[model samples]
Structures are given as structure tokens and as C-alpha cells.
Target: MSDVFSGVYEINSPDVVSEYFEDQAVILNLATGHYYSLGGIAGSLWGLLIGGHATDAILENLAAQQPQLVEGASAFVAELISFGLIRQARAGAPGMSIDVAWTSEAPKLEVFEDLAELIAADPVHDVDLEAGWPVLRPQS
Candidate 1:
């Protein structure tokens, strides 16, 4: 079974269209017509924001899947928090909030899953799961 922080992201389903970066495999989400870039270690971190994994579990999964990036995880996470892309879930939740920035009404849960699958399949740059994080190239 996947852990809380398995880097598995889902979409808000309510509003947003995401695409992979051209120069790098990093993913970018355009929410409320705003662009959010998620690359290198942050790309994986963004994946978790979609809501499948718990914060701690996602961290644990990151450690197991990409040990090298583990050292940078905290800092990367901090940046995400600062960007308002991610926020504390609630007073007592074990997860963070992912601002999907839906302009319209919220979508059904299944739609989010579908979006996740699409994003996973179409990374901005090529990815090798067994390898460490991909080097984020300059955007063209």
C-alpha cells in the first residue's frame, strides 16, 4: 500500500489544467488562470499535495523512494508553504491543504483521480523512478 506521502497527487477536479514543463519534466498547474511551477524535488512534493497521502507518510515515502532528496525535503516543503500552494490542513488533520483554485463548482472525487493519472503519465520531462530526482533544466 502507498504511504501517506507517497508523492501521489490528485487534482482538485473543480478547476485547473496542468501540464509538464517543456525544458524539464516538472509539472505545472494553472489554477484560477495562475501558473504554478513545480520542478525537481518540488515536483514530487506537489504530487503529494493532491491529497492521497498523509504528510508524514508522504515524507516517509519520499525517504524510501528518493533518499537523496530527503535532505532537501524540509526546505522544499517550506517553500511550497510560503507560496500558498500548500497549507496546513486543519487544526487536527495530519495533512496539508492543496489550493486547487477551482473557479467553478467542485468536481467529484473520481475526476480528481483521473486528473492525477493524466498528470503522472505526462511528466514535463522524462522521469526514471529508480533514479534520484531529475536535474531541473532551465526553462526555454
Candidate 2:
């Protein structure tokens, strides 16, 4: 781990919102309207990231639980950064490390663009006055 990624991270707020359900995490980037699904190990990793744990601490914790996952941790966090869902926090917060049980599953970030246009549309301002609040303008 030469390039030991340091610092904690925070979700891109005011534009991104995420919720974890069961073993999956649903993250929506309102500005882009591209939602992502992260399940299993990826979902658990996300929880840890948002928990404000330092990257090095997170990797160390995950590696302790599942040595194999450390190899993918950097890429997983990179993917999250590329998607504009999270960014390195200016001031790191003190937090706990990963707590999920070890697993061999490879972390993944599943992206969906099916409802991008609709999701990005402003329901309160982009709706047709005659058609009502729920009726949004057709995809352009």
C-alpha cells in the first residue's frame, strides 16, 4: 500500500442522497439523475465510508476481515468519486472502522440511466401547469 489513500470522505450533499436497504444501497445523484445500486460488500463499504472513517483505517479494517477486499477497496472508492457521489472531506471526522462480516464477494457499483431524464426533471417547476404536478415535461 505505497499510495496509501488517507483522509475521510463525505457524501456529495445537497445533490446526492443514499439509503441502505437489506443488503443494498440506493444512491441517487439529483444533479445527474443517475442512481446507483451497491449490494453486499459494496454496500457495507459505503456505510463505512460515510461513517467518516479515514481511508487508511477503512482499508486496514477491511483487510483484517477479508484480506482479498483490500485489493478492490481503492477502485471501489475511486468509482464512488468518479460518480460524483462522494469527495474527500476537507476536515476528517473521527469514526469507527468497517464492522461487517468478511466476505469474498467483489465490490461493485451498478449504475442505472433508465430514469435519468425523469428523475432530473423538476417536479415542482418543470411540470406542465395544465397537466398538473406529477405530469412532467416529456424527455427532450
Highest TM-score against the true fold, candidate: 2
Give the residue spans of candidate 2 off by over 4 A: 2-4, 95-97, 138-140
Residue-wise C-alpha lDDT for candidate 1, range 1-140, written one tens digit per residue: 32223333344344444455652223233342334555454554555554454555655666565555554665555545443445444333355544322222211111123344334432455444455344233335
Judge candidate 1 against the unseen true structure and give its global Cα lDDT, from 0 to 1: 0.44
Q: How far is candidate 1 from the true structure (C-alpha RMSD, Å)?
A: 17.1
- Highest lDDT scorer: 2
lDDT of each: 0.44, 0.82
Off by over 4 Å in 1: 1-34, 91-140
Error of 1 at 4 (Å): 15
Clash pairs of candidate 1? 4-53, 4-54, 4-58, 5-57, 5-58, 25-124, 25-125
Report lDDT (Cα) of residue 100, candidate 2: 67
